[model samples]
Target: MVSKVTTVAFQGIEAVPVDVQVHVGPGMVAFNVVGLPDKAVGESRERVRAALSASGLALPAKRVTVNLAPADLPKEGSHYDLPIALGVMAAIGAIPAEFLHGYAVLGELGLDGTLAPVAGVLPAAMGASALGKGLICPAASGSEAAWADRDMDILAPRSLIQLANHFKGTQVLSRPVAKLHGNAGPLPDLAEVKGQETARRALEIAAAGGHNLLMTGPPGSGKSMLASRLPSILPPLTPRELLEVSMIASLAGELAEGKLTDRRPFRAPHHSASMAALVGGGLKARPGEVSLA
Candidate 1:
């Protein structure tokens, strides 16, 4: 028998649909995740096995194949662990297939059946909302995903055990709430910084027009110190900007306490950093300090 559950493959902020199809066939025991899975997704096999064993379940003695459909897309990250495991559970009749539909799950499984948080939950939940689907996410991240579509149905289960309990009707998973801040932090005051009259003028212009300023001064110049103080005079992050920055930070796994960023980012990488790291479109195509800020 075959069981299917919906998940997502992330490319930047875009979430491509992934259909987790678990097929069990009579043969020598085998388990695998197919369809362009990256190192992280592929490693989920061992994690799922350990989690299932810890949860008092075992892979059936048969060829169990997990196919992440739309095979051409590149699948990355351990978020696929939950859907793959749930698919197998449904296929093995451990969980009812009826409860499997309409929910998109994203999480990483620990050896002891713990539900570890994974990146990209916010974007995945956004995609799930667009598709009129509910989200099943880790406890740590449900608040983060809750920022995308606050009213969307979401299940934030703390662990595999809890999730199983919820599925079996022993408990209920509650919807996560967005923790995005609507105000900026109490920034450092600007009155304490004494001198540099001309430099302060340039600083004001940079803040006003959002222009670039190259300060050429001696070693004792307050370049670093002055830059650190800009957050004080900067405007508060609106709700929209907070979500954008938070989404980026979320994908980078840098969100703290599920708190959204309220202050404008001020990233000043070392001047000696490599070009590939500074520019976003380099070989790695990663967001450099400019984009991160």
Candidate 2:
């Protein structure tokens, strides 16, 4: 029989759906994973094998083949590990196939069967929610995913055993609460500057009207110091803007502790930055300073 599990593939900050198809049949004792998977994704078989064994499940001796469908989109990252393993479990009847049908799963698995946090959980959660599906992810990322939608279903399991137990009705998993990063302290006051009336006036005008101010001065002219205080005077991001910022940060893997902040993003690249570094696009097509800001 064949079993399928839904997951996602990240393209920039967007999450694209990917279907994992697992088949177990009577034949030679072999296991294989197919699809246009990158090196990290290709190695999931070993991680899945070790993780399942640690979870007290042994692989049946049969011809087992897994295919990440669409077969054209390049699959990357270790997040495919959990879905592939779950697909195998469902195919082998270790876990009920019904439970996985409504959820999209993404996470990495350790040799000990513990789930490891992976990047792009926030975006993945958003995508899953858009599709009207639930999400299964690492516990560490549950709080991050919770921010995607309050009413969205999320399963943040700590290990393969925990997930299996929850599906088996032996244990129940609770939804994670969303978290925010508290401000460290009050920002620097503009009043601290003793002089430079013209510069101060320009800074104030720029802040009020949402304009950029170019400061040209000699050494020790306090250009950097003046720029640092801009955030204090600027307005905070709106809810929609906040989500957009957080999504970019999520894809860049820069969201600290998975906490979203209200402060507006302020990015200042060095003078020597390349064209690609200024705008978004490079070898990996990653977001740059302009896009982040």
Candidate 3:
């Protein structure tokens, strides 16, 4: 019999579904992982083995074959550690296979059986919520997943033993609360400037109209001061805009403590940045500075 666990892969900010299949059956005493996994994923076997051992579970002397489905898609990251471990557990009857049917799991596992936080938990939670499934992630990332949906079912466990205990009804895990950042502390006051009346007026106009501003002047012209104070007069981001900005920041793994903020993002790319850097399309096709700004 095969035990399957659902997880996700990332392409840019999008989360793509991945199936981790584990089978333990009569044959030579061997363990193998298949599918087009990258280096990080290929090495999960050792981590999973050590983690399970730490959790007091031992692999049976049977052929253990794990396959990541959709064989062509490149699987990556140590986040697969949790789901893969869970799949193995389910296959060995250490945990009930039916218990995991409703959830998608992602987390990195420490050799001591602890769950380590990983990037992209927010996006993975969002994907699971969209699919009408619960999410299981590291405890440190619970607050991040909580932002996806207040009603979504989430289980954030600190370790493999803790999660197993929860499933066995020996312990219970609490849902995490979504965290929000307080108001961006005090924007620079526009009144501090003593001169540059023209620049000040232009700044005012741009703030009022939500228009972009480019200040061109020689050194010591108060350009930097004027730009810094612009936020004082600019309106705070609307709720929808705040979420949009937060999503991009989350995808970039920049959201601290999983706290959402109302402050508008301000990005300053280096002058040497190429057009591709500004407009996107590097080897990984990451979001561009222009888009982020």
Candidate 4:
């Protein structure tokens, strides 16, 4: 029997759906994963094997084939581990196949059956919500996923055994609450600057009118200091802007403790930063500093 689970592949900040199809059937005893998986995804077989063994379940002594569909999309990241493992579990009847029907799953699996947090959970949660499905992510990332929508169903488990128990009705997994990073005191205020009245006026105008301000001055003339204080003078992000900023930060793995914050981002790239570092273009096309800004 073939059992399927839903997950996502990220393109920039967008989460594209991918189906994990696992088939455990009669054949030579071998495990194979296919469908354009990158190195991290290709290695999920060993991780899944060891995790299941640690959880006291072993792979069936038959041929096992895991296919990530659509055949043309290149899958990346360790986030596929949980979905693939769950697909195999359903295939072997370890968990009821129908139990996974309405959720999207993503997380990395440890050799000892623990679940590790993976990046892009927020975007994946948003994508799952768009599909009218719930989200199953690692416990560490549950707070981040909870920001997708209040009414969306979310199941966050710390390990394979914990999730299995939840599915088997031995334990119940509660939805995680969305978290905000506590304010680390107040931001550096423009009032702290002793001089540079002209520069301060420019900063105020830029903050009030939302216009760009370019600062140029000799070293120790407060150019960098004034720039650092700009966020303090600026208004807090609107709800939509907060989500947009947090999503970019989430995809970049910069959201500390899976918590969001209302403060505007402040990025100061070094003079030696490369084009790709500033603009974001690599083999994976990850979000760059500008996107986080």
Candidate 5:
């Protein structure tokens, strides 16, 4: 027979739906990931096996194939890591099918079977919310998932041991709260730059109205250093900005500890970035600096 669960394959900021289908049948010892997985997804077989073994479960000496659909759409990201692992968990009867039925899950697994954070929890939460499903994420990503829903059913399990326990009625998993405070500190008043007084006045005008400024000069003119201090004067990301940044991090699969980055983005792209890299149009259209920033 077969078992199925849902996760996502991200193309830029857009998340394409994917179904993780697991089939367990008697045969030789072979594990395959199908439907156009990239190098990362192909490598998940070893990680999945090692993770389960650490959790004290072994794959039966049977042929197992994981089909990520739709086959025409290429699958990407380590965010598929946990859902693939749990799909096998369900197929092998290690966890109740019902427990997984309502959630769309994703996370990378450690060889020792701990759950490591994966990117894209924010966008995944958005997709899950749209579908009215909850999400299961790595414990480190719990706080990042606070944007899903106030009563968001996002469960952040610190480890497989806890996950298994939660599934078997031996433990409970709590919801993660979204709380990040802002701070204001005294600044070196614009009156401080003695060498470039004209430039300092321009800086004040730019800072006062939240207007963008252009600084054209030769090397060693302090252009770079002046740009670096912009954050010292700007505001923090709003909850919505945090969600967008978190989603970019999620799609890139880089959300850490679910703590939204407090700084607004300021980017200077390299002239060498390829069209695909610049436009989020790789074979999978990964997030370009425009999307990430």
Candidate 6:
């Protein structure tokens, strides 16, 4: 029998749906994963094997094939671990196949059966909501996913066994609450400036009218200092803006403990930073300092 599970593949900040198909059947005993998986995704077979063994389940002594659908799309990240594992379990009748049909699942699995947090949970949650599906993510990312939609169903399990128990009706898992970062002390205030009255006026006008201000001065002339205090004078981010900012931060893996804050972002890059450092470019094309700001 072939069991299928829903998951996602990230392209930039967007979460594109991917189906995980697992088949356990009569053949030579081997495990294979196909469909344009990157190294991280290819290695999930071992993690899933060990995790299931730790959770008191084992793969059958038959041929097992896992295919990530849309064979042309390149899949990356460790987040596929959970869905692939769950797909295998459902194929072997360890969990009811229908149980996973309603959610978009993404998380990393430890060798000891624990679940590790993965990046892009917020965007994945939003994509799942758009599909009218719920989200199943690591417990550590539950707060971040909760921000997607209040009425959306979410299952934030700590480990493989915990999730299995919940599905079997032996345990009940509650939805995780959204969290906001606590005040990290006070922000710099422009009122404390001893001088630079002209620079301060320019900062205020920039803040009030939402205009860009360019500052140039000799070293230690309070250019950097005045720029640092600009966020303090600016208004707090609106709810919509806060969500947008948090989503960018989430993709960059900069959200501390999956908690978000309302303060406007303040980025200070070194003058000698490279173009890629400022604008973001890498194997995965992750967001850079400017994008985070």
lDDT tens digits by residue: candidate 2, 31-81? 889999888988999999999999999989998899998899889888999
Give Cα distance to truth, residue 250, candidate 4, Å: 0.6
> In model 5, which range of ten residues has the least summed lDDT?
181-190
lDDT values for all models: 0.83, 0.91, 0.86, 0.93, 0.79, 0.95
Model 3 ranges off by over 4 Å: 182-184, 272-288
TM-score of each candidate structure, all chains considered together: 0.91, 0.93, 0.89, 0.98, 0.85, 0.98
Candidate 5, residue 79: Cα displacement in angstroms equals 2.3
What tens-digit string does per-residue lDDT give for candidate 5 at 1-293? 57788888776666666899999898888999999999889999999999999989999889998999999987776777788888898898898877887888888888898888877777778888888889888888888777768887888998887888998989999888874533346443433445776776677678779787999999789776676666566777787877777777667655555666666766667768877667675555567777776
RMSD of 5: 3.1
Give per-residue CA lDDT, model 4, range 264-291, as digits (tens).
9999898799999999989877788788
* Candidate 1 per-residue lDDT over residues 1-293, each given as its tens digit: 99999999877767788999999999889898899888888989999999999999998889999999999887878899999989999999999987879888889998998888888788788889999999998898888888888679899887788988998988987787778555545656566789877777778888888788787777668887788777777787798887777766777677765557678887879879887657655422346666678
Would you list the clashing residue pairs of candidate 5? 119-253, 119-254, 120-250, 144-258
lDDT per residue for candidate 6 within 1-293, as digits (tens), equals 99999999998889999999999999999999999999999999999999999999999999999999998999999999999999999999999999999999999999999999999999999999999999999999999999999999999999999999999999999999999999799999999998888898999999999998888878988898989999999999998998899989998888887788999999999999988889998888888888988
2 or 5, greater by lDDT: 2
**Regarding TM-score, does 3 or 4 come out ahead?**
4
- lDDT tens digits, residue span 124-228, model 3: 888998999999999987888898888999999999999999999999999989877776568779998887888889998998898988879887778777887
Give the local distance difference test score of model 1.
Answer: 0.83
Once model 3 is optimally superposed onto the true structure by TM-score, how far is the C-alpha of residue 26 displaced, in angstroms? 3.2
Runs in model 5 deviating more than 4 A are 179-191, 195-197, 207-210, 250-255, 268-292
User: Model 5 Cα displacement at 10 (Å)?
Assistant: 0.8
Q: Which portions of model 1 miss their true places by more than 4 Å?
A: 180-186, 280-286
**lDDT of candidate 6 at residue 184, scale 0 to 100:** 91
* lDDT for position 133 in model 5: 85
Candidate 6 lDDT: 0.95
Please say which candidate is ahead in lDDT: 1 or 6. Answer: 6
Q: What is the RMSD of candidate 6?
A: 0.9
